[model samples]
Target: MTSASELLALRSELTGSLVLPGDDAYEAARTPWNLSVDQRPAAIAEPADIADLQAILRTATAAGLGVTVQPNGHGANGDLSGVVLIRPKRFDLLAVDEQARVLRAGAGVNWGRALERLDGTGLVALAGSNPEVNVVALAIAGGQSMFSRRYGITARSIISVEFVDAAGTVHRVSDADDAELMWALRGGGGLFGIVTEIELALYPGDAIFGGGLMFPAEVAEAVVTAAFELARDEPELGLDVGMMHFPDAPQAPPHLRGRTVATVALVHVGDEATGRAFADRIVAVAEPISDTLTSFTIGSLAAVAAEPVEPMPSADFGVALDGLDDAFAREFVDAFTRGAARGLTRCGIRAMGGAIADELGAEFAAVGATQADALMSCSVLLFDPTIDVDAAFAPMRDLAARYPGGATLPTFLSSGATLADAYDRDVLDRLAAVKQRVDPGGVIRSNRPLG
Candidate 1:
């Protein structure tokens, strides 16, 4: 075991910023984006190089201190008491192989930077709905996206991964080599190892047709009704629709921007003519107050959804359904618009299927429990961090209970305590076994519910 002196010696070997428990920067280093999470880790280590990461890992393992790694601290697992954190501010390696159609990035890189770097290359990675989120954390957590219907989850596009194991060893994992670890890394979150860098398959994103369409609140029901009908037959169009409610204010646009109204953001990753035609059909159902559906690059797609750029206290709840019927679609629209208190909620239901549901014939599983219904993911956010979480979650619990069938999205499950609540028993059991085999001492615990 590493003594305090030995730990100090190991720390001296690193050239990156290291924050100990009582250091001034320690508090900032340990804190996550979600203000509700308050973890007092033993130390926060930022490794400047792969060798430095190896040293930290070895020291932590010898010290018997659990390790928790995060790229940008978006969705940390749980309280990190008595553990150490590996923040990747120092590991910012990015490489793009155009011939291979893949881009490799260090785990610490943010989505916006990656998108900016890959711009004009005719290649784009599967970024999160929000740009500020980290690439590695999102992929490890099995991210969902605006283009999920066409490309599947972020993990599916991963071509290779480089991580440091619990034993303080480095390993490179790919589909052709170390296939088991590759499969586990896809949707397993961070149960197995701490990823240093990951290689992902990039898609051509020169000019994809995608943007938001604003509709009047008066016809939210009719608009959603027609949208559900269009989604049913046009599964091949790679379309995604998100329903939003914006408060009436001068800060919003002149059209439907300032009004507390319903809006849908649509993206058709096809030719401009075909995409514009689909938009025309959608608008025909209900004349929208404003329509901005136009051609855009993949990097700019984040603006269409326009999710908050700043970090805030956020809570998410979801339901996966068996089928999409008019009754269910109407119910979904009503909950976000008519049912919400003051109509102050921003809700979206991504009609997931098509390419995502294709038979990949891999042991790695997909959260496909709902084969009959459309998957509805709901997120509720409060700009102020001081709001009481219990009060905020009360309405969401009620909403989940009111759904046609009650089930949470695995990716949206916020707490480590709710892992089983998100995933089924069989999936949880398999993850537990894999965790046991890889980290026998449970040395790599985080805000994850692997129990």
Candidate 2:
């Protein structure tokens, strides 16, 4: 065990605060955005800058403590015991180059802040539905973004990555400088090192046709079939269909109280006329109870899925599908509706194809290799004080077992999933080689470590 005197000596070398177990701020410091996870880290370090981060790494290594880094902690797993949790929110720097269509964001920057910086520039970053998620983390983990259909996964857009390795050595890597590390960092999770900043390429587009179309629970099967057809027929359009169960809680909207609904959310990158035509095709499938589809600025992209903005406790299970065929669609609709009745709050299947499947070169390869046609996921909020969270997740688990697919995305894999479950043997071997080269000591550890 590290003595208090040693801990204090390590703290003296940093320009940031260190919260031990007894510190008043320790609980909040260790708390992640996903409230369901309870991470009791040995110590929490709030690094003010890169220099402080280096110090923390060196100090932790000297003390023989494993280091885990989290910017906003969106994907926090509950096994952080005996590890030094480093929160680098102080490196919140964002620089946008409109002329070159590039964005350089620090580890502390989130998608919402990056979008704000790119406003009115006729440019958009490949960002996920949750605007508050950390930009660096998402990019490193191969983000599935709003524009994933047109542009591939978000990790392929990275121009460069700046990180400190386990040995406390700083390295700025790109496709040219370190091709192997670049490939691994793109979607290899946080095993190699602690990334401090990333430079990403941005696309040129301002207006997008984006919104949701909600249908009554009775027509969910038909809706899923229609949405699948749309995804297959028009791979250029970004689309996701969600089967939701809204409880009769006081916090829920009055109209949706105690009801199950199927929502088809979409975003098209082209002109408003083409977008309207696509929306019309969906409307032709079934009469929507609510239609919010309209032309909107890219800044408002997060509203397309209507994902909750605030932090909350959530558990999710995901599986990749070869395609959402008629049989699978019916099965999904029935299973989701039944699961909702059993306490599942949200279940969604996102269409994945188009540029996502294209060969983006070995250096740009990410976890979401263009093979899977769709991704199905289920989530539940742990809000009720008396509810059994594990029991609530049972239905979703059964659904996954009944309709198992190829490989799952590392970005959306559950805590129980292993690296082998997300990657092929060849890919896993390559990732392990890279990990051995960069973090041979295994000083840096993440939720999914490359073996």
Which of the numbered candidates is closest to the native, going by highest lDDT? 2
lDDT of 2: 0.81
Off by over 4 Å in 2: 1-4, 366-368, 385-395
Q: For residue 404, what is the lDDT in candidate 1?
A: 46
List candidate 1 stretches off by more than 4 Å.
1-10, 237-259, 342-344, 362-373, 383-409, 416-418
lDDT string, candidate 1, 32-103, tens digits: 876656777778888888788778777877887778887677767567776778888767888888778888
Model 2: ten consecutive residues of lowest lDDT: 361-370
Error of 2 at 253 (Å): 1.5
List clashing residue pairs in candidate 2.
Answer: 357-370
Colliding residue pairs in candidate 1: 77-447, 78-447, 248-258, 321-373, 322-372, 322-373, 323-372, 323-373
| Clash number by candidate, in order | 8, 1
